[model samples]
Target: MSFWRAVLAIIFPPLSVLGKGCGSFFIVFLLWICGWVPGVIAALVILNNPER
Candidate 1:
């Protein structure tokens, strides 16, 4: 991920991974709705995991 993306992930988790595809966006969005911290954590994990 780029510097701006990292920044976006921190500020708004769901918007940051939009380019990653619909599934990722949906998962992150759900996590975000559940809780702020979990969503950020999920976004970071998903962003880091290339295999996903």
Candidate 2:
């Protein structure tokens, strides 16, 4: 659900901070600027990925 996704975006930024093919640091930075939800989602997605 979006609620949980948003929550994940807050807890872990590096995973959910989706950007224009940017690196982790950039993604994290963007996520921080955007808000907590984006960060958590980025972090979660990154963590969820098996290939990392």
Candidate 3:
């Protein structure tokens, strides 16, 4: 993940993973609604995905 992306993921998780895909965005957004920590974790995982 880029430095800014990592920072963004911690600050506002969903936006960090926006370009990852609709599915990824939806997943992170939902997790965000549930709780910010889960959302941050999800965003980091999606953003750091190896296949990207």
C-alpha lDDT of all candidate models, in order? 0.90, 0.59, 0.93
TM-score, each model?
0.88, 0.51, 0.94
Per-residue lDDT of model 1, residues 1-52, tens digit only = 7888888888999999898899999999999999988889989888888785
Instruction: Tell me the tens digit of each residue's lDDT in model 2 across 1-52.
Output: 2566446466656544453246865766677679866665666666456564
Per-model RMSD to reference: 1.1, 6.7, 0.7
Residue 44 error, candidate 1, Å: 0.8
How displaced is residue 31 in candidate 3, in Å?
Answer: 0.2
Instruction: Give me the displacement of residue 29 in model 2, in angstroms.
Output: 2.4
TM-score order of candidates, top first: 3, 1, 2
Worst 10 residues of 2 by lDDT: 12-21
Query: Which lDDT value does model 2 have at 30?
Result: 77
The candidate scoring highest on lDDT is 3
Candidate 2 RMSD computed on C-alpha atoms after optimal superposition onto the true structure = 6.7
**Candidate 3, 6-47: lDDT as tens digits:** 999999998999888889999999999999999999999998
Off by over 4 Å in 2: 1-22
Clash count list over all predictions: 0, 11, 0
